[model samples]
Target: MVRTIILALGLMLSVAAQAQEAKRADVEALLEASNMDAMIESIYAQTNKMFAGMGQQLGIKPDEQQLFDDYMNEVTSAMRKEVSWAKMKEPMVQIYLKHYSDKEIKDMLAFYQSETGQSMVKKMPAVTQDSMMLSQQMLQNFLPKIQVIAEDFNQKLQAHRQAK
Candidate 1:
């Protein structure tokens, strides 16, 4: 009876291990279908554009352009090394496992493998890029109001401190 119990426990452990492996595989497949590498590249591209705009606003001299470009290149290289899909894949998988059930992961995998899903994945980078630009423009438009509010708050704080 003891031997039978031990065998049954081992079988259950094996099944659980197999299920975990299957779930991990599905999660990986879903991430692949999502084109995460492209997403990362898109973020890097956007960062470059933002920094270039800042440099222009800062009035970087023509002769300094080379130095700025070189610096940007180094930043991009570091980002690629540190945040590459290969380095992030395991942690991302674990995060998915923590948040999603096995069935949900499988369902997402199926969707990402479909035609509509593929189309969305292909266009997602551009969509994100445009969204970021819109956000930046909005912020630029609103900055003067924020600055005025901040100045008013600072003056009030100074007055309160002096009163104390």
Candidate 2:
């Protein structure tokens, strides 16, 4: 009975591993459709912001849109097929399998394939763009305050050294 049980478990595990391996690429492709492009675009947008600020600060005007587009084009040129199998799937699958059953992954995939899920995928780039802009704006807003604090600390250190 013990041997039989072990054999049965082994077979089940093998089947599951195969299923995960097969569906992984499909999921990766779906994730890639939005994820990869969004990541590249984000890089472009940040670069655009940096150059725009530099142009303003240095009195050298950079064509913001053109600079952004040019950087995006360069990123696209380097884009290739999936980098690796692991890139397609989060490493948490091993834990997911341990915690959640096969049914959960399938259900999640099914939901993701649904209209709402499709819409989320479609809007993700815009969502990422807006979020990135907000985050960068926040960082830029904080910069002056950070600089002030750093300068205050530096002045105090300089005074202390002079007194010593």
Q: Point out the worst 10-residue segment of candidate 2 by lDDT.
A: 79-88
Model 2, residue pairs in steric clash: none
Q: How far is candidate 1 from the true structure (C-alpha RMSD, Å)?
A: 1.3
Tens-digit lDDT track for model 1 on 1-164?
99999999999999999999999998889999998878878888888888788769878899999998898788879988998888988999999999999889888888989999999999998899889989999999999999999999999999999999
TM-score of each: 0.94, 0.56
- For residue 32, model 2's alpha carbon misses the true position, in angstroms, by 5.3
lDDT of each: 0.90, 0.65
lDDT of 2 by residue, 1-164 (tens): 99999999999999988987866654554455435445555555655566555545665445565675575556544442343334434753444555655566667667667888778877776786788779988998999999999999999999999999
* Candidate 1: stretches off by over 4 Å: none
